[model samples]
Target chain A: MSALLAIEGLRAGYGETEVLRGLDLVVNAGEIVTVLGSNGVGKSTLNRTLSGVLRARAGAIRFDGAPIERESCAAIVACGLIHVPEGRRVFPNLSVRENLDLGSYARGKPRRAQNRERVFSIFPRLRERASQYAGTLSGGEQQMLAIGRGLMAEPKLLILDEPSLGLSPLLVEELFGLIKRIHADGVSVLLVEQNVVQSLEVADRAYILAEGQFAMSGPAGQIAADPELKRTYLGL
Target chain B: MLSPVILIPVLLNGLMTGAVYALIALGLTLIYGVLHIINFAHGAMLTAAMFACYFAFKTLGIDPYLSLFVLAPVFFALGYVLQRFVIGPASHGEDRNMLLVTLGLAVVIENALLVNFRGDTRTIDVPYAFATINLGFTFLAVPRLVGFVAVFVVAIALWLIMSLTDTGRAIRAVAKEKLGAQLQGIDVPHIYAVTFGLGTACVAIAACLLMPSYYVNPGAGNAFVLVAFTIVVLGGMGSVPGALIGGLTIGVVESLCSLFLGDSLGQVGIFLIFIAVLLVRPQGLFGAKA
Candidate 1:
């Protein structure tokens, strides 16, 4: 399958600290590709670079066959490469509806009403609290709102950074299930998560990032069966 | 009927003053809302616009308010370019830097006015400046009434622009969350400049409106600046509605103070209110919920 996104030899850093070093990755169309990593291992950094929040020091970011490494973050979003950032960065002061409305500020204004309906269908709780401030949401609900806002953009390739972070085990399972359902709808996903086992179960392909480089990558089942991953990441 | 001879005119003048105060505060609050910067130079921009209008009238003999159509866009472009090149560069991710830059701009403008115009207060002598509408009970100065109405219209228009237009939505988005708005393809720098322009445009409106009623001088800007700051704080920093309410509140308070005490102590009383309100509600009247 043709790749929706291809990052080759991607290197990026903040000031004196290099966070990503020669990281090669790919997300194919209609596929769920999870990047598994421990905390502070540059997985989030990869997402930021891909989403144009951080310019790559040296690398090629090919999104739908276009070089996008030097593009501004706003330009990147206009191209439909939506990144649902870590920590559920919802506009705390805005109402739930306004937050979702702003998501379509890039490329989906024409379909804002339609997308709002679609998002509400995906997360009914957001609809119920549409007028309420996003800051007051429960953690899980805020995560849902963040993901819902991302979906409002109608992304070509959704990069979910730490989607399951700070969620209860049950909510984590539900989030994973929802992601799988999103994948079933033929939307490509680049899932970054520390929940290695759950991510592996849902993702079609998996890459293990350690120290800003890909240590191992293959079919999900192989990454899951590898004895080293469990011992190193899971303390098995 | 009976009271305006004794009290009605004073009340009317108070409301008119409140209206003008609200207009000035609205500009200040808009800048604060989007940029999180207290624009120390906002009053100077207003005074600058007043001078621009003054020249437009003195040279071309055009009515001051009529010249607003031309003057507003001129000031908007001026503000946009100023924010883009000068203020934008200085505001680099630090609030203190922004504050200092605007304060410097204020000083520069004030001094420029001093050099050219001297410290003399100049007034726009429109034929109607002396016209008064005689109600049954008292006489209402036509210029003050017009200023009051203009302030009301401008306030409503600004609120609508922020609520309805595409650019307005982008601004409100930026105001609420900068990064999140940027993620949605809102050109942040452009938005910032546009916001500054819009804020400054309010000054143009106020300056045009104030021309007939007030005197213009180098330090005249300082009067509105102090009152504008108080209004912004009183209304709630960056809160548009708060600016409006706060302006009206201060206007009425000042009027009452002037009525009961005198014009000299009116300002002192208003300052007292500012202190008491800040002590009670640190966030001001319409500030964001902490």
Candidate 2:
């Protein structure tokens, strides 16, 4: 399979301090790639830079064989790289349905109604609470809504930033199951997470990020099996 | 006397005036809803709209009612450009920066008006200026009656725009979550400009409605601005319906207070109610979420 999203020599950071230094990664089409990192390792900064919200200090980002390093957030989304940001940033005042509908505001315009139904089927709780404001939902329900909203965009490559955040262990299991089902639909998944064990179970490959670069990279099962790798790097 | 015959006219007068006040506050509230900033330029913008209305009538013989059609769009475009190119870029979506930017804009617009107009109070001589609706108890000016009716129409129109249109949907989404809105590919700057334009258009409509009954000068809008700010706060910052009800309540209170305590001191009734509401329910008449 060809690379759906490819990054080489990626570097980005806030002013005067670099966080992501010469990082290289690839997510081939129809694959689940997990980027596991500890806090302050710049997982969010990497996501932000890839999504074009943060300007990449220096990088070449190829998405579907075209350079998108200079594209705007809107342009990146239009090209079908949907980023479900951390913290489940659903519109609080807007109803669940409105939140889902807004997902296709830029790209999947023609298939908006169709995609919304598809999203609802994936997250039945969202359908039940369709009329309720997003902020009023339970934490798990809000995360479901956030993912459902992202699905409504018809993303070819879905970058989920810490999807299991603040979710109970039971809910995390369900969220991972949902992620697998989403990936089964031919959408490449880039799962960025601090929940390393749960993420590796779902991801086909895993990349451990440490101090702004990948410390170890390989198949998820292989990475999880290596005792020295786990002992020195993962602390597991 | 507290008799129905005497008090009813005063209440009616207050309601009609309150309708116009509601429209003015609606403009301010719309801006606050989307931008999360109390626009310091709102009064100056109103003064500017009043001058435009006056010029449309005096120089071109366009009736104030008819000029609403012309002036609203013009001001809409002006507001769109102001927010899009000026406020949006300068403020970078920060609330404090927006406050400063709008405040600076207000100073510039007011001083520009003062320099150009020379502090002269202007009024229009519309043929309908003296026309009145003869209620059994009192005569209400026809223009004020028209304003009372038109404010509802405008409110309904604004409501429809906010709830129904795609642009409105984008606007609401941005107001709630700018980052999420951007991720959805909604052009945030465009929505901010559209919202500001819609708010300014409301001011234009208010200017047209007021021109028939009110006098205008460089500082004319300053009188409305303070009361509008109070209504925005009392109504809850972004609630359109809240502003409407709050304005009417304040208007009636002001009217009844004046009947007992003369005119100048009577205006304090609005502030008194404002303080009471803030003290009792800090969220104002409506719950605070925009």
Candidate 3:
């Protein structure tokens, strides 16, 4: 199987300080690949660079066999590369239904109604509170709404950034289950997460990022079983 | 002592003045809502539109109302270019810089008009300038009535566009959350340009409507700008309906104060109400608390 997204020598950062340096990664079709890293390990930066929110300082990023290194964020989204950003940046003023409708502003506009129905089916709680303002939702519900909004775009590759950050343990398990279900629907997911064991359980392959580069990479089960990795990063 | 019969004409005149004020405030509020910038150049843009209509009347003998077709597109294009070239880059910078840039733009445009039109007051002498509509109880100036009706039509059109169209949804999305809009593949810079264009178009329409009754000068917008600001603040910074209500309220207040307190102190009453609104409900009558 060929890769859906390929990045090589990716370098990105804020002004005068580099976060990601010479990072190389690949996400293949029909797989869940988690980039596990602690806070400030450039995981968010990676997602930002890939989504074209931040300009890649120096790198080549190819999505779906085309170089998108110079593409605008909107253009990248038009190609079905959707990013559910960190901190659930849902439009607080807009209703749940309006937020989901806006998700199809670019790629899924033609099928907005159909995609909205699909998202509503997937997240029935969102459907129940469709008219409620997004800001009024609980943290877990907000996360679900964010993901559901991303799904409204009909993304080929969905990049989730710290989706389980503020959710409770029970909600985290449900979110992981939802991620697994999403994968089953044939969407490629790049799960940038800190939830080690849970992410390992769901991801087909895992890469541990440290100091702006991959420290260890292998099958999920292998990484989870490694005594050194469990002791050092996972804290198991 | 003012008689109760005089109150009727004062109220009718207030409504007419309020309609024009609503048009100006709507443009200011819409631009502020979407762009997150208090556009100081809005008044200058209105002045530019007035001048454009004036020139069209002088050269082509086009009636002020008919000149809307020509002026709206021109001002819209000017606004688009202004946003794209001047405001877009500065938008991402400091709020202070955006404020200063718009202020500077206002100065430049005002002075340009002063140089071109030589600060002389100009008014289009339409045949119905002094015509009055008799409603048995009150008399309505023909131009003012037209402007009053036009304000409702424009307001309804804007509300419909915002609620019904895809482009309007995208604009609202951007105003609410810009990053989310971009993630949805919205060209945010393009949206900004279009929104600025729409705001300018509103001013163009206002200028055309006011041509018959109001004089056009380089500084004509200065007085209206102060009132527009008051209306937008009173209506809420970004609320369309709020602007209309605020405008009407100010108009009535101005008329009543001028009647009872004398013309010299009319604005004093407006300033007091403005201060009271700020002290009591800083969000304005219709504004959502931020």
Candidate 4:
């Protein structure tokens, strides 16, 4: 399959502290690829770079055969590469419905009403609280809202950064299950997380990030069965 | 016993003055609410708007009210470009950079005007500046009454736009949470410019409305600016409804104080209320309970 997003020697950072140093990552079309890493391992930096919040220094990022190195955050989003950032950045004071409306702001205004219905179907709890302030949502509900918002853009590839962070074990299972369902629907996803076992369980392919670059990457089942992964990440 | 004849004009005057105060306060509160910066230049912008009206009226001979048709959009465009190009980039982050920048702009505008116009206080001398409506109980000054109607109409229109429009939703989203709005693909710089434009447009409208009622001078905006700050603090910063309630409340109270104590003491009296509101409920009367 052709790569939906290809990052080659991606170097980026905030100020002088370089977080992503010569990183090479890929998300192929019609696949779920997880970038597994520990805290501060530059997984979020990678996500932010792709999302255009931080510009890449001395690297190339091609989305669907188009070089997007110079595109703005809004312009990148308009190209259908949606990023659902960590900590559930829902517009807190706005109503749940309004937050969802903002998701389609860049690319999908005409189908906003229709896509909102689609999101409501995927997360019924969001519909019940449509008029309520998004800040009042539980951690899990906010995660759902964040993903639902990503879907509202009708994205070609959805990059989710630490979706399972701060969620309960059961909620994590539910969230991973939702991710699997979304992947099954032919949407490409770059799932970045620390939940190695659970993420590898559902992901089509997995990249193990140590330091600022990929240490290992392969089919999910193979990565799950890797002896070092068991000893290092899973502590089995 | 005071008959209805005596009581009606007092009530009319209070409502009319209250309306003008509310209009000016809306602009001040809007800037305070979304930008999280006290735009000291706001009153200066109001003065600028008055100047725009003067040029439109005196040079072109358009009536002061009719000049709003010309001046409002011009000021709106001016506000948008100014906020976007000059203020937005320099005012990023948690620092008080935006406040200082606007304050500096205000000082510059005030001094520039002082040099150009001298210290003479000028009022728009339109035919209707002297007209009055006989309201049976009290004779309502035509200009003040017009100002009252204009305030409510503009306030309601703005409220509707903010509540209902897509652009308005983007603005509300930004005001509520900047980072979240950014992730949602809201171009925050664009939103900031639009918010400033909307806020400044309100000032433009107020300048036009005030032309027929108050004297126009470089220092004139200082008086309304004081009252506008009081209203924003009292109404809760960033709350539109709070602006209206806070403004009208300040207007009536200030008028009543003027009646009882004298003109200068009225402002001193209102400052006490600001202090009391800050002490008791710093969130302001109608602000969202955070």
Deviation (Å) of A153 in candidate 3:
1.4
Best by DockQ: 2
**DockQ rank order:** 2, 3, 4, 1
**After superposition, which runs of candidate 4 have C-alpha atoms over 4 Å from their true positions?**
A231-236, B1-8, B92-95, B288-290
B1-290, model 1: which lDDT tens digit per residue? 33556676777787888888888898889988988888888988988999988888999998988988888888888888888889988778675688899999999998998999998888878899889998877888888889889888888887788766768878887887776676666788888889899889888988888898788887877798799889888889999899988998898888888878887888876899889878998799889756
- Looking at model 3, what is the TM-score of chain A? 0.97
lDDT of 3 by residue, B68-129 (tens): 87888888899989987897777665545667788989999999999988989998888988
lDDT of 4 at A59: 94
Q: Candidate 3, overall lDDT?
A: 0.89
Please write out the lDDT profile of model 4 over residues B1-290, one tens digit for every residue: 45756555655676678777788889878877788888888889998889878777778888878887778788889889888988876777542787888888899989999999998888767889889987655677898888889899999889898878878888888876776677667898898899889888888998888898777888888888888888888998888888888877887787767766778787776798999999999989988766
Give lDDT tens digits, candidate 2, residues B181-208: 8888888888889999988998899999
Query: Could you report the Cα RMSD, in angstroms, for every candidate shown?
Result: 2.1, 1.7, 1.7, 1.9
In model 1, state the lDDT of residue A107: 77
Error of 3 at B269 (Å): 1.7
Question: Which has the better lDDT: candidate 1, or candidate 2?
Answer: 2
| Alpha carbon deviation, residue B271, candidate 3 (Å) | 1.4
Cα lDDT tens digits, model 1, A64-158, are 98999999988899888999988878888778997888788887889999999988988899999999999999999999998988988889988
Q: Least accurate stretch of 10 residues (summed lDDT) in model 3 chain B?
A: B90-99
lDDT of 2 by residue, A143-195 (tens): 89988888888999999999998999999999999999999988899999999
In model 1, residue pairs whose N, Cα or C atoms come closer than 3 Å (at least 3 residues apart or on different chains), thus clashing, are B4-B8
* Chain A TM-scores, candidates in order: 0.97, 0.98, 0.97, 0.97
TM-score of each: 0.95, 0.96, 0.96, 0.96
